[model samples]
Target: MSLLNGLPAHVLLVHVVVVLVPLTALVLVICALWPQGARRLGPALPVLALVTLASVPLTTGAGEWLERHVADDPLVRRHAELGDGMLPWALGLFVLAAGVWLISRRTPAAQAGARSGAVLRVAAAVLSVVVAAGAVVEVYRIGDSGAKAAWHDAYSKTATRPGDGD
Candidate 1:
């Protein structure tokens, strides 16, 4: 039930979101741009999007809980703020993925070649690509801030200076 003996579930869960969201975004962009890929992906893109969207809240909730117990350092505060900004992008990706999937499914196969329907699909695909790109960027931003907050100091201390012991 607890991650590493109550070691803040966010520490563990953040990795999942970090990996899954970007991977999903890449696949989503591919599926959006390529009909063949979309046919192959079927429901996977939407499902992945949903999973990524769900993880946002879980990670943030765990992070929020941990925030109280940890040092009130500016790093942690900034990380929390960056994490909050990710939710909307994640939700947007989910909605876009769902819309693309629904549009693909509802549009009759026979009519998929029709001019207007084709245009609609193309438009949806473009939107999905844009939203997925945003989600990817947001994830990177969140992760980078978190890494800086968590490891910058530790890593800096370990780096050997040019004139050390000289």
Candidate 2:
């Protein structure tokens, strides 16, 4: 069985990663800042993080495969480079989500302890916020670059077609 069955996997998987990663980041930030929200989300945050993390590598691998089959242009290369940088941010958000989940699971007494009480919770929240912010920014960067690479030339060509007015 062929891996992609003659289709470009990148075209199929990029959408999932693009949508899920930012969504996960937003959820992570919300859970971090809101205790009741975190309680309601329960196990969902970590699971979302895991899925987002998994999707990144898949999207990247597909992108690499697609890259090999396409002409090397500055826009595509820039998008590829930006895409390669996404894994770390995705991984960081995953780690932060896991950390937040673990911290939230501790007992009331354990959370109230001197070392692991309010201070730890605050620290986790702050760190989660920072990581979530970074992840969101990275997602925007990747999406913007990818969109530009994918459409810039097509739009340019269309605009410059014969008999077309400026």
Choose the strongest candidate by lDDT: 2
Tens-digit lDDT track of model 2 for 73-149: 89899999999999998898899888777777777676666674677778878988888788878878888998888
lDDT of each: 0.81, 0.83
TM-score, candidate 1, is 0.85
lDDT of 2: 0.83
lDDT string for model 1 (32-129, tens) is 77766766678987899889989989999889888888777898899999899988888888887776766656546654668877887788788877
Worst-scoring 10-residue span by lDDT in model 2:
157-166
lDDT of 1: 0.81
**Highest TM-score against the true fold, candidate:** 2
TM agreement with the true structure for every prediction: 0.85, 0.85
- Model 1 bad stretches (over 4 Å): 1-4, 106-109, 155-166
